[model samples]
Target: MTKALLKYTGEVEWTPPAIYKSSCKIDVLYFPFDQQSCNMRFGSWTYNGFQVDLKHMNQKPGSNIVPVGINLSEFYLSVEWDIIRVPAIRNEEYYPCCKEPFSDIVFNLTMRRKTLFYTVNLIIPCVGITFLTVLVYYLPADSGEKVSLCSSILVSLTVFFLLLAEIIPPTSLAVPLLGKYILFTMIIVSLSICVTVGVLNIHFRGPSTHTMGPCMRKIFLHIMPKILFMRRPPYNPGDILYREDTDGDGYIDGDYSIDSCGDIKDGSKDCLNYDCSNFKSGLHDDEHRGRASVADADNVIPRQLTPEILSAFEGVRFIAQHIKDADKDNEIVEDWKYVSMVLDRFFLCVFTAACVLGTCGIIFQAPSLYDNTAPIDIQMTRITQYGISSPPTVAPRL
Candidate 1:
């Protein structure tokens, strides 16, 4: 028997097999079969390949090779995989299409692309919902139709989360890009709902001129509740809402005044009757609800906003300043209240940006998607004393 030894190029940084000084080898054996398994026969066909130890796979650095009994002339491909699907680990072999080993084994590999399904879906929707948040700042608050645009976006975000959960297998795996965005969409949606509550809260407090501007009142009453910031106190008893026959007409007084909050200091000036005898029923109050009713509500107008509402809504003072022109004070108060509605939009933007940026920061830290991401190497060889040279085929990078 003639022995052919193939040497390692050392171009591959690997420890040598102890049996060989400078070479590792494969022995080729040719067998003749008159008949194969009863059902099958290679009547006119020639076959090639090798059997390698499953434990000691031979491969170059940065390569995944699955060894099979074959030669370079036959075929070239090596695939790596884990039998158990264990994460971050792989098992593989190369059917170099040959019976030779070491340098004589020639192989070629083509890379396959891996797509991140979660990232695409999650990211797009995250951006879409973020845009709607900005839209909140632009739409008119008093449409009376209720700022419904926010509700629509909020619902969309919920569907996105459900969709993501369906597509991805739950694992202790690092959070996926898409999963993060879905989470963000949900967060933004929740925030938008809160903002809507704020708008409603402000509107519920009667008109803009009476107490805090509607917008300001909304933030103080509703949205802030989520942050545990403060609760909007139910409005107070109009300081002057007492049952008295002021003009002896026998009808009790039903007036609401900011001065209701005063503790005898402002003196009964606002508490006094407005001389309603000459005054007709308030056409403005009749147009709106939540005001001095036929009598003050049993939950009577609050003497003042809940102390908590008073503290969290510093923005109310800002609205009060806008009522500059005395003649138009009422109208300006309403407008300032309108401006306050945006506080909901403002807070959501702040939170959404934080969530998106945080998700992006997570992606930047992932493994680089490039040539070295996934590696494949193939090998094929034929054993013979006579030397045979094969050309290296250009392989695609992963």
Candidate 2:
């Protein structure tokens, strides 16, 4: 009111500095990329609309001019939030207790959270941990580190979840996108631990401990190897042939000396009592005549072979049978190990794909992640003395 009467129009202006604390409802569905709108209403407490009127200070004296919501020429910038828009409107309302209308100015403060801090501190580290979870399948089972690695990663994700719990408000309405991603990653890690245990069990299995079944052998050894593009050397029983000269005979005891009839020679009674006539039943016409002649030669030969030679022959057969059984067992054990390897390769592919897709799907669910458009300009329709009227729309500022 200082010197206001001196002016021809008698208008006075006053500027005051004030601080306000506002409580805004936070929607953390998109978290760091989220936008929030908080309204600040200003009005005189005692005077009614008829006695005291409220108007946007930036409104001009033209019908087509748009009202600037707030003066930002001297506004200080914030590090964590960007002011998207500040739209103000003048409202009039009639209360039940009063005959006159109440007037107020409402300023809608729209802000977007800046994502660089969350990206650097939270997001990138989470992505790294997700990739590390995939690496658990790559480590060899014999290295004895897979379970330990999974445990460490699970603990790390738990720590991250705890940190996020502290940052986010304790509301049960909805879970934040970042929290969902962390939980998903933790679950994948936990499953990896179970998979590692299974793989280790398969890798160390022995024929004596667990016999390989037909279905398992077909899936892991026959089918999965081809699907995963794995290659292995074909098993050769002869390659693992073991020879022992138990009596300095310089011959592999595993090799049995056989006659033309496929029976052991050197006076084994089982061979001496051989039923040569049985060969005729399955032989062709010419093969039967050849076997008939061989049977006559077999009948003339060898009841004179000594008891000591027979005992040596039996001992050699026993050693040979033992060696053959050992080789078969060894092959089975190796097959189990190979099957374990195939499983590791299979899971490596699966976890890598799941981790990549799940991470991208969850992270990109926020609309603002890919949106590059400029901030929207909110136009306020003027509420005039007669009625509400549509105002001229302005293009958004870039």
Candidate 3:
């Protein structure tokens, strides 16, 4: 017959120091919200079945066990996990014939990672660096660092991700929310670098390097700037009015008209300061138009010639060729500058949208860790109670 104490006091008291070993495999899904259950089995090693009975010291009649003596704030690990304790029971199953049940106390530590460390060290810095990516669009393409800056930042983010990997344990179940956020931001930053490369390619193009196709010119130079509210550089009036080669001709066209007598007149200036007669006489002479008799008449009259007029006409062709070459070179440089502005405006719109969306997506996915609804004690109790149900429910399935 089992013994029952006849003179048992309603108040039960027992205390003892013991060492407990834990065989806990940590599950880190929902990392910062992760909970761990460490098992502590209490029993006498030699005493089998009826010889030893392990009882819960803190259990009360008509009520379940409530873990106490845990002050999470006092624990040295407060900087990391928000600790909690949950007490549970189960029998050890080493021998089939053993009749006594072993006391199983489970210390279920329900943890919520303290976010201030990650927030300050990882979140804020990553966000700040991501926001800085927008500035790459604002940088002057001519400064020659827009692509270089974006590349450096992309590499910096990669290094940051590598540093983060070293800090957090590798897991395939779920990535830490903060780490995921950093990774998402890194991808967007990489995309920014790609966009910058494209912008730089457009910025560096010139008439010598690449001719702006008509479609590209219409969209980038003409249409897109207004939609993006970009300010264009002031147009140089001389570029359109005095084009050196409006036609596809290899030679510069004279900005003048020749009269019936073959005399050149500057219609724009409403002036005729020089005649091409000396040039004509030197090249064609009496055969020009029907001026054979006129040239014969001029030969009969002797006229005094001066070194000044003759010298001016002698260098006329050289001076004209020099001016045309200078204008053509200037035109190519201006075309490149205009094309760069168009491309800059286009990429500014693209990169800004990417930055905003990436930041929002990364930050919004993290669950709120700092909820005020539950007290520390209640949180611990709830988590432990929840874990206790898992073994019974899952065992039948197994």
Best by lDDT: 2
Please say which candidate is ahead in lDDT: 1 or 2: 2
Candidate 3 has its poorest 10 consecutive residues by lDDT at: 389-398
lDDT tens digits by residue: candidate 1, 1-398:
33433347322222333332222221111000001111111111132222221111334456434232112332323232101111121233234564433122223222232333333545555666756665664465666543577677777777776776675545553465555555656676666667667766664443433556577556644665556443343332323433556465443334443323222122222222342211223423432755544344223323424565434333433343342233255444444454454454556556557656865664444333322433222222222235443644531111
Clashing pairs in 3: none
Q: Looking at candidate 1, what is the lDDT of residue 322?
A: 40
Off by over 4 Å in 2: 1-14, 60-68, 169-172, 239-313, 373-398
Ranking of models by TM-score = 2, 3, 1
Model 3 alpha-carbon drift over 4 Å, by segment: 1-16, 19-24, 27-77, 84-106, 170-174, 239-335, 368-370, 373-398
Task: Please give the CA lDDT of all the candidate structures.
Answer: 0.41, 0.71, 0.55
lDDT of 3 by residue, 71-188 (tens): 2321233456554444444344456556654433433445455667767877778888887787887888778887788787778788778877886777776777667766777777
lDDT of 2 by residue, 129-157 (tens): 98998888889888999999999999999
Which candidate tops TM-score? 2
lDDT of 2 at 73: 40
> What's the residue-level lDDT of 81 in candidate 2?
74
TM-score pick, better of 1 and 2: 2
Residue 10 CA displacement from its true place in model 1, Å: 22
